[model samples]
Each structure stands twice: as structure tokens, then as C-alpha cells.
Target: MNNPIVLNAFRFVLLLLAQVLIFNGLNFMGTINPMVYVIFLYWYPIKENRAVFLLVAFLLGLLIDIFSDSLALHTLAILTAAFARPFIMRFCFGVNYEFQNFTFKNTTKIQRITYLALLIVLHHTIFFCFEILSFSHILLILKKILSTSLLTIFLCTLFSSLFSPKSE
Candidate 1:
């Protein structure tokens, strides 16, 4: 059960199911969609191969796109977030991120929250931007980004805390 591949595969299936079956149905005021699947990117091992991570990210997003029927919006947004993850880690964790031994468990609450918020916001921004595809509806795009990001961030933080291994 401790195998990384097995664990990640389980997580991928679980999150994809949750997103498609549960979160996809939730549309608060027809704006918010809690994309908790992005947590896969957050929880992925920092030391793992970047190409593999990106490939996993692509598959995750593509599946979401297929399920949601939103064209390639989710694919584009998730790929961008995955690509930007290292820079976001550097910004949030500072020198700590450079260490090979770094883990989210070792970071302060503020650092972890900042990292999650940035990723959620970045993903939402790209999603809504391409989704709307119009600066004429810029207000709509910004509103969707803010609302969705908040809900997604909260769910992601909760899931992370609930599932993270305890430091006995």
C-alpha cells in the first residue's frame, strides 16, 4: 500500500471519479466548480521525474475535459499549472524547495496555504480565460476565477490534511 505507483494510481482514479461524479454537478450560482483533482499536482512527489508528472497532469486534465465536455479548457489549464508548479514552489517555499528532502509536511501552514492558493488561482484564471474567450466578459471571468478558486482551495486543503500521513 505504501508503493508510490499504486498510491498515485489510486489517487488518480479516486480524484477523477470525485471530480466527474460529485464536483462536476456542483455549480454554485452557476460559477463555481470545485476542481479538487488539481490536488494531484500538489501532492505529486517533488523528486519524481518532471516529464512523468507532466504526463500524468495531462492525462488527468484530458480525462476531466472528456467528462465535463468542456473542450480542452481543463487540459490547457491543468497543464499550465503543472508547468508553473516549480516556480510557484520556489516562490512559496523559498530555499526550502531546493532541498531534495523537502516535503509539504515540513513547511509552515502559511507556506502550504500560499502554495495551494497560487496554484488554484492560476488554474482557475487560465480556465476561465479560455472558457470565456472574451475580454468583454472580463468581469465574469474574474468572478468565476475568484469563487471557484476559493472553493477548490478549501477542498484541497481539507483533503490534504485528512489524507496526509501522520508524523508519529
Candidate 2:
């Protein structure tokens, strides 16, 4: 059998490089960017250690921050998503869901979308909140959150639908 742990590590590296080297540069609409890179965290094996999850999240965010030069908001957003992952997974898979086998191929598209939607919203929420900590302009924050979330959802859904395995 393939070692899932090693496979995930390999995935992490490949995805990170893709995000940093290519995706980050593709500004779709000025500021409404689609960060599909965070999907790595979203797809991480639920059975893995929480500490490892958080550490990986922090490092992932750090890399984005370094590459994007954006005041660590990416790290903060990813870490928040990491922290909330268990709860999200539980909601998506039910309380009895097995983490090791959680996957889009095994679930309905709606279930997958719901799971990803919540995390995408949560991630953008945390990210923009930090971006607007001063709370100086309510309108701008609302606009950014809404626009970014919409764009991100569209892109993530597109990618998930395209790449998800054909069969379990």
C-alpha cells in the first residue's frame, strides 16, 4: 500500500511550490485572488496529529507570507483554518466519520462544497479581519470579504471538481 503520510508530504511540497511560483502571481481581479493553495490544509489527513497540523499550517502560512510579502495574514488565515479543521470535518462527515479515509471522492459534491465553503469563508474572514484590524472602513472590509470569498469559492469548486478522483 502507498504510504499516505509520505504522499501527503510530497503533495504539500508540490502544492506550495505551485502556489508560490505561479498561482500567487495570477491576480484575477485586482485584489479578488483565488488561493487554491490552502486546499492542501483542507485536504490534510484528519487522523494526523493536531500539533503537526497546526505546525504545518503555520509553516504553510509563513511560506505564503514570505513569498507574497503580506504581513503574515496568510499564515494567520491558514492557522485559523487548521484550528477549525476538526470541527469542520466533523460537521461534514458526521461525528462517526473516519479521518483517515475522508475524501471528496467518497462524498457527494454538495458535501464537498459545503465543507470547502465553510473553510474558505472562515479563512477569508480571518485574513481580512487582520487586514482591517483598525476597523476604519466598514464598507471596504465588507466589499473585500464578499468579493474575495466569492472568487475563492468559485475557483476552489472548479479545481475540486476537476481534480477529484473518478471513483473511490
Candidate 3:
């Protein structure tokens, strides 16, 4: 069995490349920019140490920010998502979704999709909110939140189903 740590690192690299090389090139209607890469953060073993989780989240978003060259707050968004992950998982998946111990092999597809969808929304909301810190374009921010959330959910569902782990 592949250790979760190794798997996570590999997934992180793959997601970063995918985001920078492929998804970054895709921008539709200035709305449907899907960031399926965040799924790696979503799926990272729940049992990983809290500090490690936050660090990884920061780094993950930092990588995305570097490649996207949008802003520095992207890392903060990712860190927020990671910081809130345990709470969200507990609330949504119950105690069974404990960090460092959870895996796709033990989860239902519906559950995985639902929980991940929430995280994606949370992450994107923070990211876009920071992207538009000024209140001048609140309407545009709202549009970005809605459209990007929809696109991310759809893409993440597809990617998770296709790439979910085969065993616990």
C-alpha cells in the first residue's frame, strides 16, 4: 500500500502541474474557471498533523498563486480551507472522517463529493473574496463565487470519481 504521505506529495505535484499547465489556460466567460487542483487538499489524509495540514495548504495555494500570478492571498485562502477542514469534515462526515486516517477506499462516492464540494466552495469563496478585497465590485465577486463554485464542483466530482483511491 502506498503511504498517505507519499501519495499526498505526489498528488500535490500533479495538481500543481495540472493547474499551471492546463486549467490555468482555461478561462470561459470570465466565470467558469475550474480549479480542480484544490481537490488534493480536500483529499489529503485527515489524520495528518494540524500544523502540517496548514503548512501544506499554504504551500499548495502558494504554488497556485505563483503559477497564476494573480495575488499572494491565494495562499491565505488555501490555508483557511485547510484550517477549517477538520471542522467541516467532522460536521459533514461525522467523526469517521478523522484526519490522517480517512481514505477514499472507506468512503462513499456521494459522501466524498458532498464533503469535497463544501471545501471547494469554502476555499474558492475565501480566495475570490481576497482577490477582490475592495467593495467596489461586490457584484462581480458574487458572480465569480457562484460560477466558480459550480464549475469546481462539477470538475471535482468528475476528477475524484476518476482518480479516487482503489483501496483503504
Clash number by candidate, in order: 0, 0, 6
Once model 1 is optimally superposed onto the true structure by TM-score, how far is the C-alpha of residue 116 displaced, in angstroms?
Answer: 0.7
Off by over 4 Å in 1: none
Against the hidden true structure, what lDDT does model 2 obtain? Answer: 0.79
TM-score of 1: 0.95
Predictions ranked by TM-score, top down? Answer: 1, 3, 2
TM-score head-to-head 2 vs 3, winner: 3
Off by over 4 Å in 2: 98-106, 165-168
Better of 1 and 2 by TM-score: 1
Writing each residue's lDDT as its tens digit, candidate 2 over 27-142 gives: 77775667777788766766778998899889988988898888999999999999998789789878656655655566677877888988988998888888788677777878
The digit string of per-residue lDDT tens for model 3 on 1-168 reads: 388878888988999999888887788776467888878776787665889888888888888898889877678877887888878778777777655566656766677777888888898888888888879988988889889888889988888778767764
Candidate 2 all-Cα RMSD: 2.4
Q: Estimate each model's TM-score.
A: 0.95, 0.86, 0.89
Among all windows of 10 consecutive residues in model 2, the one with the lowest summed lDDT is: 159-168
Error of 1 at 42 (Å): 0.7
- lDDT of model 3 at residue 120? 86
